[model samples]
Target: MTRTTLALALAAALALAACDRGPANGAPAAAPTAGAPQAQAGQDAAAELDALYAEFWEESLRLNPLSATYIGDSRYNDQLPDTFSAEFRQRQLDFAQRWLERVRGYDVEQLEGQARLSYEIFVSSLEEQIEGERFPGWQQPLNQFYSFPSSFAMLGSGTGAQPFRTVADYDNWLARASNIPTLFDSAMANMREGMANGVVQPRVLVEKTLPQLDGLIKDDPEQTLFWRPIAEMPEDFPEAERDRLTEAYRSLIADTLMPAYRALRRFTAEEYLPAARDSHGLDALPDGEAWYAFNVRRITTTDLTPAQIHDIGLAEVERIHGEMRQVMQEVGFEGDLQAFFEYMTTDPAFTYESEEALLADYRAFEATVDARVGELFSLTPKAAFEIRPVEAFRAQSAAGGSYMRPSEDGSRPGIFYVNTYDLPTRKTWDRDALYLHEAIPGHHFQIALQQELEGIPTFRRFGGQTAYIEGWGLYAESLGRELGVYADPYTYFGRLQAELWRAIRLVVDTGLHSKGWIREQVIQYMKDNSATSDTEAVSETERYMAIPGQALAYKVGELKIKELRARAEAALGEAFDPRAFHAEVLGDGSLPLDVLEAKIDRWIAAQS
Candidate 1:
C-alpha cells in the first residue's frame, strides 16, 4: 500500500529542505576559530537559513492543518482550508514563489556540507511546487483512492490521526468538521470546472466513489461513522459536559455533515458521472501527455520517460519470472508459470479462514521479524507499531496493506493497516512479504525513524518523495530471507510475487497512462503475469487509474536502492557493512533519487 495521509494533496509537491548543518547524518563539522571572519559569516548565513526553514514549516502547518494534526501538532486542529478553491490555489502558488526567491537569495556556494544540500533541496521543492501548478490537479481532486471527503471521514471517525481523547480534541473536531459543506461546495465547483474543460475523473472511479459516499451518508446522525467519538465519549467528563457534547455532535452530523455528504453524492451521481470520461489514461485529457510526463518525473524523481519505465518493467517481469520458476522447481511443481500462479492464488490451503485468523497471523509474524531484525540493521526507530485490520468504509478501494507513521510527539503508535475485506483473497503466502513491506523494516522503520530524526527541518522530517519512500518499502521486502523469514519455498515465492507485482505496476501504470492500455487490459496483464487474485487486480487497476504515475515509484525506487547496494558491496568488497549502508541510505529523510545517489556515493568515498 502507498502512503496515505490527510495532509494536503499537494503536500508532496513541496520540496524537503534540510535543517541541521553538517552531513545527512546530522553530525557536526569541525568548528572554525572565533577570530576567523569567514567562519563567522558562514555561521551567520546558516543561522539565517535555519530561521527561514522554521518559519516556512510553521506557515505551512497553518496552510494545511491536517498536516499539522498528522504530525502531532495541535496548534491548528480547529482549522480547515478550502484547498480546492481558485483563491487557495493562487495562494499556494504565491507562497511557493515567495519562498523560492527567499531561499535562492542565500549564496549556495558559500554554504557548506548539509547546509548546501538543504539549500539545493529547498529550491528544487519550491520550483516543483510552482511547476506542478501547471497541471491543475485540483480540477480532478475526487477519486476512489483519496479525496477530501474520504479523508475528512477518516479524521472524524476517531480512529485515524485525529485525536479524540480530550474535551478540547472533541471540540476541535466539531469546529473543523463544520466546514465540510463549504469544502464540498468548493470541490464540486472545481470538478464542474473540470467537467467543462474535459478534465474529469474516469467513470469507473466515480462509480466506485458513489458507494463509498453512500456508506457514510445516513439519515440518522447516530448511525454514521462521524458519531463514533460521541458514542465512545469519555466517562470521566462531568455529566452536563457529556450531555452537551453529545447533543452538539448529533446536531453537527445532522445539520452540517449529512447534508453536505448527500449533496456531494447527488452531484457525483447526477451530473459528474454523465460527463465522466470513458477513456482511462491521463494522456486522453488536454495537455495530458505532458502532464503525465511531469508526474513520471516527480513521482519517480527521475527523467526516465514512460516508454523507458515500461521497457524496464518488461525486463524486470522476465527476470522475476525466472526466479519464480526456481521457486516452482524447488517445490517440485509440475506446471508452467501460469499454473503455478493459479495454484498459488486459488488453492484453498493458502486462504485465511477468518479475519481474526488473518490478523493473528500478522501479529505473530511481527514477533517473528523482531526476533532476528537485529542481524540485518542496528539502526531502528523508537516508535512502535500495531497491526490492525483496515476500517470497513474504505477497505474496498484500499491496498492490501499500508503504513501510517507515528505522531511526532510519540503519543500514537505507527499503524500497519492490513486489509481483511475479502478474507478469501488474504493469502497466507502473501502475509510475510506484506508485513515486511508495510510494517517492520519497511515503511514503519523508514518513516517513523525519519520522524524521530533530530535537527532536520520539519519539511525534511515530514516531507516525502514517493520514489524514496515507497522504493524503500519495496526494497525492504527483498530482505525477507536475510531477516530470517521467507523460510518456505512458498513464502519465498510470495516475496518474488510481491516484487513481480511492483514490476508489473511499472508496465501497467505506464501502459494505461502513456501507452493506451485500457483498464481491462491492465487487469489482464496483472493476472497473466503474477499470482494476484481477482480482487487485488481490480482494486490495484482502479488505483492506477485514479492516481497516474504513482505505481511507477515502487519498482523504480526499489531498483535504484538495489543498484546502490550492489555498487556499495562491489566497491567496498568485504569491507562493506550492510548496517552502515542502510544507515547511510536512511540517515537523512526522503530525497530526490539523484540527491540520494550523490549522498550514497559520498559514503562510499568515505569508506574507501
Candidate 2:
C-alpha cells in the first residue's frame, strides 16, 4: 500500500493521532546548563506545554479533516478539501515544517513523562512528513490494495466508518459521497501522470482493479451499497428534505458515480493496462529503490535494508518449516512436505460446509478463546467485536482475516472480517489461530484499549507502529495453546502454519521487491512449505506484491515480542506474570519494537 493508503486507513481508525519526531540528523545539542533561563523556563513549562499541544492538535485536526470525522468530531465533515491538489499538498508540507519549528524550540528537558513523549512524537511526525516530501507518492495513488474507489465503497457500505443514524449523519455522508467524482478524477489524472512518469501500477494490479470497479457499478441505485443512506434516511428528517435528498442521491448514483466508476474501469483496462509494467517490483520505476526503501522504513519502523529483511525471512521460514515437519510426523503423514501440504488442502474434513458455517466456526472460536484469556492476559478492552465474512466484492482478494478497529464513539463495534470467498481454501485448520490473532484479545483488545485511554495525547493513542501492532497480533496467535484452543494436533499445526506464512512473507515480500523474484516463484515456494491452497497462495503473493514491505512487519514484530517474553521468563524466574507482562507490552498502545523492548527491560529490572 502507498503511504497515503496506510495513512488514510490509520487516520480513519483514529489510531495514530500523535505527532512523530524524525531521528536527529546530527549530534544532540548539549543539555541546557543548570539554572539557565532555558532550564528555569523548562521547570515552569507544563501549563504552557499543555496549551501548545492542544493548539497543535486542533490545527492538525483541521489539516487532516477525515481524521476529525473518524473521531466523532463533525466540524470538518462537510469540507471535502482537495487533498490531491498541489496547493493542498504544499500546505501540508508547510504545516509540518512550521509545527516542527514551533515544538522543537520548546525546552523538552523541562517536560515530564507523558508531555515529553508528546513532544517527541510531534516533532518526529513532522520530520517524517517533511522527509517524505522527497518521494513522489501522489504520482502512484491507484493500487488494487487500496484506492479512493475502494475506500469510498467501504465508507458508503453503511456498516463502515460513515454513521447512518441521525439526519446530520446522513447529510455528512451525502456531502462526503458527493466528493467522490472529484477524487475519482484526481485519481485518473494522477494515474495519467504516473503513466507519463513510468510510475504506474503493475499490470497485474490494474487488472484486479477492473473487476473490483465492475462490482461497484449496479443498475439500481437503491440496491447499491452506496444507496444505503437514502434507504435508511432518518425518520426525523423533514419530508421535503428527505425527498429532495433521495432524488438527488439517485441522480448522483445513476449519472455521476456509476459512470465515473465505469469510465475509470474502462480507462484502466483499455488504456492503462497496456502501458502497465510487467515487472512486479517498484524498483523498476524512477527512484524506485529510494521509494521502496522509504516504504520499508515507514512500515517496519527500522532502517534495515531490504536484503537484510529478505535474509531474516529466509532464516525464519526454514526454522518454521522444521517445526511443521514435526506436525507432519504427529499426523503420521507418510510423505514429503509437499505431499503433506496437498493432503491438508484437499482433505474433506478441513473444509467448511458454507460461509455461514465458516463464520459460526470463527464465532465459536472467539467464545472458546475468551473463556481462557484470563489465564494469559489481565488487560482487556471494553469494546466488543463480531465475526463477519468479507464483503463479496473484495473477498476474492482479501486476507484470511483482518480487523477493523472500533469507532472512538463506540457506536460501531470492532469487526473481524473473515474471507469466505473460497470455502475450501478457508480451511478449518486456519480458524483457531486466525480468531486469536484478529478478534477478542488480539487487535480488539490492544487497539480499542489504546483509543479509550484518557490521559495520553490523542496522537499516541491513535498512532501505531507496524512492528508493535502486527507483532502483537502475531504474538496473540502464539497464546492459543495457553488459552486452551490448540489442543488438537491439527489446530496446533495450524498455529505453526500461521507463523510460517508470516515468515514466508518476510522472504517473499523482500524477494519480489528487492531480490527480483518472480510472482510464480513466490507462489511455488508457499505451496511447497505450507498447507495453503494454490488459490490462497497466489492471492497472498499478489497482495505482498501490491504492498511491498508490509508482510515483513508480522514476523519481524512477532519475533521481537517472543524474544522479549523469553527474556522476561528467564530473568524474572517465578516472578514472571504472563498477565502483567502482556499488560506492559500492550498498555502503552503500539510502540517501536526497540522502545517496547526498553520498556519491558525496565519492568524486568524493577521486578528484580
**TM-score of each model, paired residue for residue:** 0.96, 0.93
Model 2: how far residue 294 lies from native, Å: 2.3
Which lDDT values do the candidates have, in the order given? Answer: 0.85, 0.76
Which tens-of-lDDT digit does each residue in 1-608 have in candidate 2? 11211236321222234663222332232355676785455545555556666666777778776777665566776656666666767777776776676566566777765666667656766677678787676766766665567667777767666677766776777777677677667767877887898888788888887888888889988877788778777788889888887887888789878888888888888878998998988677788788788878877777789989888988888888888889888888898887878887899988999988887878777778878889888888888777778888877777888888777777778888888897888888898888888886678888888888777767777777777788888998898888888888888888999998998888888788877888889898888777888778988988887767788888788889999999999999998999999988987777777778888998899999
Measured on C-alpha atoms, candidate 2 has an lDDT of 0.76
lDDT of 1 by residue, 112-186 (tens): 776676777777777777788788777888899875677788889888888998899999999999887987898
lDDT score for residue 408 of model 2: 74
Error of 2 at 332 (Å): 1.8
Model 1 residue 40 lDDT? 70
